[model samples]
Target: MLSSIKRFLIGRPLKSAELGEQKLNKTKALAILSSDALSSVAYGPEQILIVLITVSAAAFWYSIPIAIGVLLLLTALILSYRQIIFAYPHGGGAYVVSKENLGINPGLIAGGSLLVDYILTVAVSVSAGTDAITSAFPFLHDYTVVIAIVFVLFITTLNLRGVTESASVLAYPVYLFVVALFILIGVGVYNIVTGQVSPALHTPVGTPVIGISLFLLLKAFASGSSALTGVEAISNAIPNFKDPAPNNAAKTLVAMGTLLAILFSGIVVLAYYYGVQPIGEVTVVSQIAEQTFGRNFMYYFVQGTTALILILAANTGYSAFPLLAVNLAKDKFIPRMFTVRGDRLGYSNGIIILGFASILLILAFEGQTEQLIPLYAVGVFIPFTLSQSGMMVKWIREKPPGWGTKLFINTTGAVISLTVTLMFFLTKFGQVWSILIFLPLIILIFHRIHKHYEAVGDQLRLTTCEPSIPVAGNVIIVPVAGITHVVEFSLNYAKSLNPHQIIAVYVPFEREEEEIFEEKWKKWQPDVRLVTLHSPYRSIIQPLTRFIDTVVHKASESDYQVTVIIPQFIPKKGWHNILHNQSSLMIRAYLLYRRNVIVTTVPYHLKK
Candidate 1:
């Protein structure tokens, strides 16, 4: 029944050959990969205002300059990642680039940072989407965490269905969002140019609590840095594109960057012209829509699409996290299960893990986008810095064609990215200190996992020597609770193994029970020997295992093997099995790690 439900939800298993068909064209790829970067426009400008407004209402004027700073940084990152795509077309992103050019530790740091950032991307995007919904409806404000988690689950399901299907479903909303925002921006700009709306210059009404300084502007820039969080996703997911993957991915990156810049700049400009503030329960975009279109269909339409694209922005994380995890798994930095593709050819394990991790963050931060924003920029910028640094190193060492230009781009990106990272740490360290702890913890875990895999590989490695000799013979032991058809079935199966000897052992709790069982066994005979073990404390497993240990020790000394046959009876229904003690299961669990001990189960199905 569970398998049937799974088939219904994700569809039938896709053949391996169908994998190539799942690669996305550029249009669909944009929707899948660029949603996070694009959706940031919904809240990125607001984040800048949120930080600046703390000084005083007059400080809101700094938003434009800070936004420009973020945009410049975004341009540098986009160019750097394009170079990343051209160089590492196989698509490991920063992790692979850093590992190859820098070293293994730097590679793991890059991988770990990106992994955490991907998780936060889902959390922050979904939470911001929820904020949009709550802004429109108001009543949903109470269920913000629940709504965010449900969106995560929905996106996770779509991704598990496969890449092409998710892209098709998610692409329309992203494009719709772009159209809606452009209409809002175009009309808002028209209003400003027509002298309908004037610049919102606020005069000082009282003493400023905190005066505007360079530190404050840096804080605001770091807040808006969320705009660039998902820019690396395209480079991380080059393999997900159609044929000519790297070229297609790079072109899509440029397209996404262009749209993001236009939308982000337009919204920021409109916000300044209209004097939009981070009002309670209402978003900056929502306020802009209300100002431009009032509470009409266009207002609701803009809100609806903003909410949708923001939610679907999680698709960026869903698309890239699994691909990055696959790279780490290949290097034995993470578990091998992450590399396993599901029936739909998606990395199912990675997708599910990303979903749960996002839900956890949403719950931890109570689905408040403002609270989660502080932790968001650091994770992304760490990888951004590492990726750019890795590319810079690659150019210097390899000195490939056009290396100077590539080196300059990456160097600028790395410096700006590192500056932003440090700014986030210094300005928002109170809220973001946990990231400091988490980054190193994640890297340590990666090393531990890698070490374990190395140890396992060494142990399983084969040499050119001859194989060891086989055991002389088999000594089988069957543990019986009582004389019954189940015991008889196990004994007959043991005899078929042609063992040197077979012992039927029983554990009796009381003297009277032992005598009665012995008398019955003697009468039945059956040409087999029976040994009885008395348990003074009524411990069945201990006494039974003790007897088996003695037999195994003797057999091993004689160059023989020991096989324990556990006799079990199958009930007509699954619930019926719960009514009986599961001795067979217990025995199997206890003997699981015992070396040189073979265990098998013989089932006697009950007719009724």
Candidate 2:
């Protein structure tokens, strides 16, 4: 029944041969990979205004220049990641690039930082999407966190179905959002040009609370840099593109960058002209829509598409996090389970884990977009710097065709990204200090995991000089609660092994029970030796294991193996099994890692 439900939700499993069909084309790929970057225009400008407006509404004018600075950084990243896409077509993004060129530690740092950013992307994007919904229908305001979590779960399910399926489902809304914003920008520009509405000339009524400084501008820039959070996703996901993966991925990256730049810049320009303020539940984009379309169909259309694209933005994280995790797993820096693809050829474990982590952040921050913004950009930029720096080193070492131009571009990107990272630390340290601690701790964890995998590999490695020898002899021990068909079945199975000896062992809490059991056992006349282990503490497993240990020690002289057969009764109903003691399970678990000790279970099925 559970399997049927799973099949229904996730669809029938795809064959390994169908994996090629799962790769996305350029059109669908842009929607899936660039939604996060494209959708940021909805709130990216607002974040800058949020920081700038603290000084006074007049200072909000600085948002345009700060946004341009962010744009320059975005341009650098897009070009740099294009180099990455072609250079490392297999696609590990910053982690692979940094590890190969920089070192192990830097690679781990890049991987860890990007992982955090991906999680934050899901949280922030969904929260902002929820905010959009509540903005349209304010009564849903109280359920913001609930709505955000529901969206996360929905996207997770979509991704679990497969990448191609998710892209197909998510593509429409992203395109709709782009078109709606473009319309809004066009209408606003026409209105300004034709004198339908004048440029915002009125200063805010409030007095300037604080004077503007270089620090203030830096703070705003850092906040707005969230626009660049998902730019590296395309490079990380080149493997997800169709044939000619590198070329297709690079083209998608360019398309994403172009759309992102136009949408982000247009929205900022319109907001400045319309005098949109980040003062209420209404977003800057929402305010611009209201001014241009005026609560009409186009207004709600923009709002609906904005809400959708923001929610779909999390699909970018879903797409990239698993790919990066698989890379880390291949390097043995994370669990091997992450490398295993599910029936859909998706990394189900990584996707599910990313969903849960994002849900946790949403809950922790109460699904407030601004509350999560401070924790957003730093994770992404650290990787940006490392990836760029790694590429710079690669160019200098390999000096491939056009290496100098590539080196210069990456060097500039590295410097800009590194500066942004520092700006985040300096300006928002009070809110984001935990990230400083988190990055190092995660790197330490990666090292520990790598070391553990190394130890496991060393132990499992085979050598040519090692001898292959079978066990000299076998002794079987069966633990019996009482004489029953279950015990008979276990004895028959043990006899089939034709071991050196077989013994039925029992431990009793009281003397009277032991005697009664012994008498019944003797009456049965099974012709097998019975070993009664007396337990003062009434612990069944301890006494039974000790007796087996004694047998094993005796058998060691003759090079005999000891096997413990456990008889289990299978209840007809799963719930009925809980009524019985699980001593068989406990015994098997305890003896699992013991050398030369084999544990087997013989089951007797019950009708009712």
TM-score (all chains, Cα) for each model: 0.96, 0.96
| CA lDDT of each prediction against the hidden true structure | 0.89, 0.90
Model 1 residue 380 distance off true place after TM-score fit, in angstroms? 0.6
**lDDT measured at residue 5 in model 1 versus the true structure, 0 to 100:** 91
TM-score of 1: 0.96
**What residue pairs are clashing in model 1?**
none
Q: For model 1, how does the per-residue alpha-carbon lDDT over 1-608 read when each residue is reduced to its tens digit? A: 88999998899899999999999999999999999999999988988888877876677667777878888988998899998898899998999999998899889888998898899999999999999999999988889998899999999989999999999999999999999999999999999889888544433233244577888888888888878889999999999999899999999999999999999999988887777888868999999999899999999999999999999999999999999999999999999999999999999999999999999989988998888777887888888899899999999999998999999999999998898899888988898899878778988899999999998887666862546647999999898888799988999899998999988888898999989998898887557788999899988889888888888889988889999999999998888987988988998898877777899999999989
Stretches off by above 4 angstroms in model 1 are 200-210, 464-469
